[model samples]
Target: MSYELRDHTADVAVEATGDTLAALFAAVADGLTAASAESVPATGGDRFDVEVTAESREALLFDYLDRLIYERDVRLVLPADHRCAVVEPNEAAREGDSADPDAWRLAAGARGVPLDAVAAREIKAVTYSEMALERRGDGWYAYVVFDV
Candidate 1:
């Protein structure tokens, strides 16, 4: 999983690439953290856990990213490394109302440093404009815009 900062007209953008859906999610989450700060601890920090559900993959990506922002803002944590797992419908899932909650869910955990303790940028919010999450060929790609 990897990410690169791309130029956005006004906001900050990141292009994430990975071989699997889980990697893509992690990369994008890492990208969001990268855009906000620099030189995070390689490992071993406070644990950050987030679970989000969305009807579609695109929305899932959006929510996942937005949640990262929320976590950073509220908890003052910046992700240094993360792992994501998608519980398939064919596999075991946490009990919830199907009609009320979205079908696809992501359970992710991250380890990051405190934002206040690091040199960080203020990311205002995540935007839907120019947002993309899709697979091409053998790889997955995600593009997200952040209002900085």
Candidate 2:
């Protein structure tokens, strides 16, 4: 998996690729952490678990990043190392609940350090602007923009 930071007029965009959905999410999460800090410590000082459910893949990406932002603000930390898994809607569930809001779920673990311990920037929010998450061939790709 890999990610690159692209320059937008005033915000920053992250483009990531992976061989699987989980890897793509992890790459993007790392990109988010990179955007928030100049450098993250090799080892993190705080750790936490994250769970988010959404109506679609795009929405899942949005909520996952939004939750990290919320965690940073509440805990005064700069989020860093991360790992995540995406659970797609099963055939049975998709056939049964057309209006299910939790069709997509993400379970993740993350590590962070105190905001004061690093040179950090403030990310106002995660936006739908140009957001994308899709499968191509046998791999996954994602793009997301962050409000700085």
Candidate 3:
């Protein structure tokens, strides 16, 4: 997985690519951390398990980033590592079995970094207006814009 950061007119833009959705999400999280210059401690002293559901991959991407923003702002959780996956609902199964509340699960490995070490301003939200997720050959790629 890989990520590239670009300067946007208002907010920062991030693009990530990977062989799988899970890898791509993880890379995106890493990209966000890199952009913020948030130092993730080496200890597994703090962490959070996050789950988000959305109707489409694009929506999932937005929700995934938004969750990260929330974690950073509300919980002071600096992402150290992340694991995410996309699960499609089974339409033919029973109602309860068919619908998974977490179409995506993001397990974030985090540890509190010194407040002074965190150099970037907080990210407010992730926007869908310019979001893009698509298949590229045998892998996948995505582009997203965030509101600072």
Highest TM-score: which candidate? 2
Residue-wise lDDT of candidate 1 within 28-117, one digit each (tens)? 888988888867766556887899878777888888888887887777777668789865443333464454443677899888688766
Between candidates 1 and 3, the TM-score winner? 1
Query: Residue by residue across 1-148, what tens digits does model 3's lDDT show?
Result: 9999978998988899999877888878778877777455555445567777776677777787887787777766555566666554443133354455435333444444444455666777778867878889999898888777
Q: Rank by lDDT, highest first.
A: 2, 1, 3
Better of 1 and 2 by lDDT: 2
Error of 1 at 64 (Å): 1.0
The global Cα lDDT (0 to 1) of model 3 is 0.70
Assess every candidate by TM-score: 0.87, 0.91, 0.80
Worst 10 residues of 1 by lDDT: 88-97
Tens digits of per-residue lDDT, candidate 2, 21-79, equal 98999999999998888788787577899988888889989999999999999989877
**Which candidate number maximizes lDDT?**
2
Clashes in model 3: which pairs?
Answer: none
Full ranking by TM-score: 2, 1, 3
User: Residue 39 error for model 3, in Å?
Assistant: 4.5
